[model samples]
Target: MAYTFEILETEKIELVIPLVYKLNNGKIDKAVLMERFSDMITYNNYECAVIYDGSKLIGVTGLWFCTRHYSGKSVEPDHVFIDENYRGKGLGKQFFEWIYNYVKDKGCEAVELNTYVSNAASHKFYFNEDFKILGFHFLKKLKK
Candidate 1:
């Protein structure tokens, strides 16, 4: 199967919003997605890409560049996802490898991402890709 990755655009927001909602377990709404997409495009913080199998969009990934004090450098890779039906097809690795090369080329010192503790399959994938777990990330949801 031939797969291609393309940077996201405003015209593609409708297609990408659903994919992002599915990937995020529907925690985000359309307005939120629109706002974030707009910010990503405007500030150039978003490196959103869609994986296409022929004419179908089967996966999505977003990378944001940021500087980390611990890493003492700029890092990329904020999120990645593949449609449930398209998992285990090596697309995840290909996505990461592409992001790795792309970020490195852009002078990013590292690429990082987080997977939930319950996501064993993702942990395995990251391990296979030679990503070492640096530490645990904890979060507290605040009332809006």
Candidate 2:
């Protein structure tokens, strides 16, 4: 029942890569992801927040701190995933509460996140957490 949350550093990101892949349906190559994540950590101003049950990792998400004219300081969390075995047990609620407090401590005025439209369960869960639908997240994947 005891859990911990920590802001992950670059050297430890591999610990959460498995859970991160879960968000993308396990389609990403581990080697490639590790390389890209390392680059992101090194250059893209992103950090990962990891959830641990005792010493074992149970969930992970990416956090990007930003400022906007309307929102001021905010933290945007992405790629959130809880271990399949740990879902639907109020852990997500605890995680978000922790994230809110974490962001506030960093002088953030808001927390924002995006979830895939087809993920209805997440939509309901987020709504239950008092999150409002702001707008659609449009993406255009450029050819590599």
**TM-scores vs. true structure, each candidate:** 0.84, 0.93
RMSD of each: 2.1, 1.3
lDDT of 1 at 35: 84
Model 2 segments more than 4 A misplaced: none
lDDT, candidate 2, equals: 0.88
* Candidate 2 Cα deviation (angstroms), residue 59: 0.5
TM-score of 1: 0.84
Question: What local distance difference test score does each model get?
Answer: 0.76, 0.88
TM-score of model 2 vs. true structure: 0.93
